[model samples]
Target: MTTTAAPEARPAERRTAPAAPPPVRRRRRRGDALGRTGPSKYLAHAGVWLYVLLLAAPLYYLVISAFKRNTDIFNQPFSPFTPLTFDNFGLAFSQASLGTAMLNSVYVTLGAELVTLLLAIPASYALARSKGAVGRMVERVFALGFLIPGFAALVPTVLLSISLGLFHTREFLILFLPASALPLTVILLTQAMRAVPAELEESAVLDGAGPLRVLWSVYVPLSVPTLTVVAILNFLSFWNEYFFSLVIIGPDAALRTAQVALPTLSIANAAQYGVLAAGIIITLVPAYLVYAVFADKMESAVLAGALKG
Candidate 1:
């Protein structure tokens, strides 16, 4: 009976369940996204390069054509290098009176820039601090100059100069150049001046500095960035001015600026492309030189003002 009970008591083997499988991870579609993104980035770079090439092409053509013989220019339009010659430059320097014209341009530009700065600096300072309706009205009036096309004012300005006996005079041209620039200069300088801290002025005053001393010592030093921009703009405008120079200077070749002289260098039948190009290149040199020196300063000045404000 005990043996039978022991046999009956033998336990059934324990049943074991199989382990569950782990979840399958969804792989990221990174390769597909990268493939799509690659084409767009390449396309953007290509577009920028194309645009740059288009802009540079004309200047390239102009320079290439300058070196080419008249026949070669027409036959080989795409060729950049020609039998490089100084003949054109020689002719421009010797015959075009470009040297004299350069002098005239320099004189006129310097005069105009000086006059514009002299007038603009104080006006800008006043406008920056002003709070009245008069100040607002003045600003609005200055802004109107931008809206008005420069060519539209040409006739009236010429007529006014004639009436005032200012026609055919360099004095008149110098005066007029600054007058033309004043509205824009005032607007730019005023905006820049407004960005300056009031505390700077207050601190200057606390040190027993007068308004003039404070402006010269503090405001002018701080506003150098804006001033440089204004000066560069004024210089460029004055330098490249042909229309005003032509109309105001009479037929006197001696009074003509470099821009006016360059086009007239060619004879009516014999157009000298090389000489014209050389003259243009020479004219561009000063502007490029000025830009090189002042470009970083100009950016920093404006950026600093913007950040402080």
Candidate 2:
């Protein structure tokens, strides 16, 4: 104890305090939420706007060109400020005999769509209901229809039309379009119809509902959106159909569809851009109205699905 006391108290070991942490640079968040998340969202928005511009540019140019004179169209091109005129429309109608062609297009499109739906709905229902090996085989056969290119079918189709004596007649289109559309129509509707709950179908059957009744009461109601989409797609296809109309219908004004008629204006007018554009607009009007009318069904279907989710 004396020795320890005597041992000169060793200089108190200097204890070093912990060093202060380096200051963290805090990022300023406006309203605690406006901090930059990423460049991707802004990039996506820019891409969408660019896509909009690309699509709108052609339509804008077409619309303005329809109103413009040839010289104005050539010179001003994209300018909507160019003088507008109704004369091109009149010229297009008269020169192309577009009024008659319009009527033909309506008849063909409506007829084709009706026939296609009638055949497709029943066939699709059969396919959807059947669970046999044969049914799968049949489905595969239908799928094969898609592999046959449209151009490849041209020769055989023309030959068949010639044999049937339907060549150069609009009637053949009414028949031929359905044949081409059946595969897609049947596939889509079959898939859609299959989505109907089996329990619902059983309940309906217990309530004395036959297959037809079940279809009309249950499947049809649920599949309206799909039907609308099919109708719209076929309408556009039949309306804008040119190659077959030109080939089978043989440029006959009495039988030619609107799509085929539009080109005659060019041949007759020496490529008057305004008149051609006007004809294009005229042909497009019916298609536009049809699409507008049916588009609501599609929108409702989408909203319903989102709400269910």
Q: Highest TM-score: give the candidate number.
A: 2
lDDT of 1 by residue, 1-309 (tens): 444444323321111111323233223342242455656877876798899999999899778866766667667778876676667666677766888888988999999999999998998888898889999998888877666556778888889889999888777888889987888788888987888899988998999999789779987888886788778777877898889888887657788888888777666216556667776777787777887887755454344333421
Top lDDT model: 2
| Cα shift from native, residue 73, model 1 (Å) | 3.9
Looking at candidate 2, what is the lDDT of residue 294? Answer: 64
What candidate 2 gets wrong by more than 4 Å, as runs, is 1-55, 296-309
Supply the global lDDT for candidate 2.
0.80
Instruction: Candidate 2: give the clashing pairs.
Output: none
Global lDDT of each candidate: 0.75, 0.80
Kindly report which residue stretches of model 1 are placed more than 4 angstroms away from their true locations once superposed.
Answer: 1-50, 68-77, 267-271, 296-309
Q: What's the CA RMSD for each of the models? A: 20.3, 18.7
Q: Could you give candidate 2's per-residue lDDT for residues 1-309 as a string of tens digits?
A: 334432232221111112333233233333333236576767767798899999999888888888889898888787788887989999999988999999999999999999999999988888999999999999888877867668777778888999999999999999999887777777778888998899999999999999999989988898886787677767777888888888888888988999999888888878578998899999999977876776655443343323321
Residue 162, candidate 2: alpha-carbon lDDT? 99
Model 2 weakest 10-residue run by lDDT: 9-18
TM-score of each: 0.77, 0.78
RMSD of 1: 20.3
